[model samples]
Target: MNNQHDPLSSRPLVSSQEYSEVKNEDFEETACEDSITQRSPSTELPAYKLRRSAWYPDMRVMISREVLAVHLVWLLILAATIYVLGRFTPEVKCGVSRLPSDVVFGDIPYQIVNWDEDSGFVNSDPLDGKRWNQSREWADSTDWTPWDDIHPGSWVQVAPSSKLGISGGIPLRDYSKDGSWDTNDEGYALTMHHQIHCLGLMKHVFISAERNEPIPSTSFRHMDHCVEYIRQSIMCYGDLTLEPLQLGSSQKAIESDTWGSKHFCRDWTALKEAVWERSTVGFDRHGFVFDKVIP
Candidate 1:
């Protein structure tokens, strides 16, 4: 019989080549599917070829590192700026001095006593009375008003000696040939009054006991006391300094006494001007005129 027609030959043995090819194809397809399943989302595409919407596997760590570097650089810059400012900026402490118990009067120093008491009774004599009368007459004859009429307060006393008169003593011809107290004297008096007011001390209005003549020792002592009180007030109210306050050339007139004589009034005015100038600067820096009470 022909082998092709034989039933036994109809189910010929399957070729080993065909079986091997089928098995190989199946194995390759399974390997491909396993590789796709095991891959992370980030690594599915090449880093450079990945779409803008896709995330890079290592980009997260790199971006975090870049951000951290930027923050560190900013922090370093801020620290450097603070250091520069602290190193270069100047420090200024504005303050004042204390009042001493004793102050200089005329050429000699005297102790301050009875600060609350009136200075009117310190030294009164027959000559002082005559001088006082003369001063009153001078004030009445001229346009000047009486001290009591001008300043009405317990701190102020109306006495012949306290009257505003010409620069000369009683006779008037001794100092000023014409019996006239110029604006200089008025300025001095005004300065004295303001200083006393600033001190907030005894209210006696007569800053100078001997109004028309040179200051006497007792009167000078009183004047010195007032000056000390003013100095102390300035210290308490504003910044203190060994150097005088400079208000520039515009305020030069305040520094100098345009009034003829070199008296306690002139000296006191100088002190006042100094304190005012310093207080102005303090105000500009600190935003306050005075730091403490006047007293």
Candidate 2:
């Protein structure tokens, strides 16, 4: 028989030469309890490759769980603080670099209001005589309008954030010439209010073949002042919109119609809301809000 084929048997095998060289003492332990597997007090596992997250660096010194958690929390706090300062803080710069990037105020701080029939500003479809109904203190109803309020002094409110152009508010012009913020003479007024008064003054002087109405003989100076003022205002907001000159019967074909000309405008609605919200009714000597209207 071949020795190679004989070695394939299931039984344990030892070479005769190696067995002859071994001493009997090598297998000396024979106690029943000792025959079973024994143990040392402690054992060590093989070293393994550790994985650290890309976020945390592998400092050679071990970082404790509590310290690592504190570091993570601190990082989160810093991130939040940066976010808040960037988000809520208002911008100080003006002219295109304002807080609200979308809102453009190339002209004046104004809220866009459509002067359709509802406004009574342009189209005559809007009815008048409703001021008394909505007024703060015109209940008894002698019937008042901006036109009526021009001569008599009145009160007005102002608080300037210096955010837009207007300072806390425009100084209350002593319209009574007495100058009070809507004191005993009348109630609140604004630039538009003053503009209306000027318009009323000029309206009294304007006369035409349209019909019969007494033309007040107020000084031509007041009339001229208003006329020039209105003229200057029209020129100031020079509508740069290209009103293409068209040929007409008249030689000066400077015929420009602004019936439907559209221009970039400020959020007039937002401005009005802000005005009403910030407008203080009255204030004391120390500039605190109260019942007494400041003179």
Single out the weakest 10-residue window by summed lDDT for candidate 2: 123-132
> What is candidate 2's lDDT per residue for 1-295, written digit by digit as tens?
2223346786444333322221234223322222243322222211221122222444533467668889999999999987665444445444333332112212235443333232333222111222212233333345444432222222345433333333342445443234544532223445444555566545434432133655445546777877787787768567555544555668666665544555556565554454444343432232111123444
Model 1, span 1-295: residue lDDT tens: 2223446666444322222221334234433444434332331343343343244535787999999999999999999987664433432223211111001111122232222323343332322221122333332323322332212111111112221222321221222323342212110123334453333222232433345544546654666777777887667556321333345578654353222332211243344343332221111111111211110
Residue 22 displacement in candidate 2 (angstroms): 75
Each prediction's Cα lDDT score? 0.34, 0.41
Report model 2's TM-score to 2 decimal places: 0.37
Clashing pairs in 1: 95-239, 95-240, 96-240, 155-203, 155-204, 155-205, 156-205
Q: What stretches of model 2 exceed 4 Å from their correct place?
A: 1-155, 159-189, 207-209, 247-254, 278-295
Model 1 scores worst on lDDT over the 10 consecutive residues at: 280-289
